[model samples]
Target: MSDEYQTSGEYLHLLSEPAWQALRTPVALALRDAASDATLLDVGAGTGLGTEVLAAAVPDGDVVAVEPSPALRAVLLSRLAARPDLRRRVTVVAGDALGVDLPARLGAVLAMNMIGHLDPDGRRAFLRRVAERLAPGAPLVLNLQPPTEPTPVPFSVFGTVPVGHHTYEGGGSAEPSGPDAVTWRMRYRVLDADGTALREDHADYRWHVIPADALLTELTEAGLTGEVGPLDVVRAVRRT
Candidate 1:
């Protein structure tokens, strides 16, 4: 699988409002303690939804929104450009967080709904980088989804929303691709007022499942302590 959000990113933005509604509170709570003037990092910031949240969370801080997908970056940039306030506070960048050149010390890190993109080795490298660059007591917040081991996920409608004169639907299914990974098949559809399909797009991506224990152990090995919170969210803090 290409695993990049080439085509999917186009439609994913349409459903972001609902996702943001669910994410807003938890994400804010996670970053509530971050210093107001500290620099914040947002990894895999697709379409800038989480980036917007981060900007709101730290009004006085600079936010670095890192996205590796060009399609997603296009939308992210557009979003920033439209809001001069966010445009001033956010610096959009390309590539993985581990490879990007960031500040010597970070105030907080947000990696929402993107950790599965990294394999075990990549995860280790990312955590190590976070450990090295994150300011002492700064938090790295991310989530771990289900099927920690490779397993099949049933096809289900993830979202269905009605716009002006059309309805947009999106859903996905996943199949075991390896011992610790799954290949997700996503389907998106646009239906006219009469309920006829006007367009459809299909995409596939890979996700490497990480068990809670495995991730906590990795955090500890990287000199960070982590706590698993509600909704499978993990908040790890760099050691002093």
Candidate 2:
């Protein structure tokens, strides 16, 4: 199985419940006004949890659940089979959001918590692609964890010397330490920009830390205007 699919399948159970709840509220806020028969795209639809929410909201609309993982695709197919009503409204595609052919003229694009998986360049490219696919004013809902606060230390060290006890510092440490040490955990996903996963084992090979402001800047550079609220999730819009 492909690494993307494997990673998705492995986390499917964990996402089945919590993800549904976490994403439902935001997705609804973005798409509630959509026509009942609107066509929606769920990019990086891991196990179709978000897709299910979209499907539920627009019972008569069509939802394209795009996922790059082979294993998760099969699982999603099985889940669809169990619900014929939703099955008819949803189409499962084995593809990546960064470079997939979206159906012509979509009403909205739902990119839930998937942007963090991409590097800065890749994220920009994906945003541009999404903007291209969406209709005017279509919303791109992005959910991501914000960077941990940086600790500040108050100390004045003028000369850098190996041996020197100058004076007592009056400020605290500037960086979080101990159990609060902030580090981006390595996460794996299916498919790279070249359309190949590093390995079939779905091993995580890199760690990433996303600064909220930097990410927003990258999105703006891509022609999408949005804001990351204090809650840390970004909801950007593609203007007509």
Q: Tell me, by TM-score, which candidate is best.
A: 1
User: What digit string (tens of lDDT, one per residue) describes model 1 on residues 1-240?
Assistant: 243788788788887779778777877787766656568999999998888878887787889999988889999999889999999889988888668887778888999888998888989998998888887677888888877889899999889889899999999999999989999999999999998999999999899998899999999999899988877778899766
What's the C-alpha lDDT at position 223 in model 2?
A: 78
- lDDT values for all models: 0.86, 0.61
The TM-score obtained by model 2 is 0.69
Collision pairs in model 1: none
- Writing each residue's lDDT as its tens digit, candidate 2 over 15-86 gives 345445665776677665454445788888876777777676667888889987777777778888999898
| Pairs that clash in candidate 2 | 4-190, 5-69, 151-174, 152-173, 152-174, 153-174
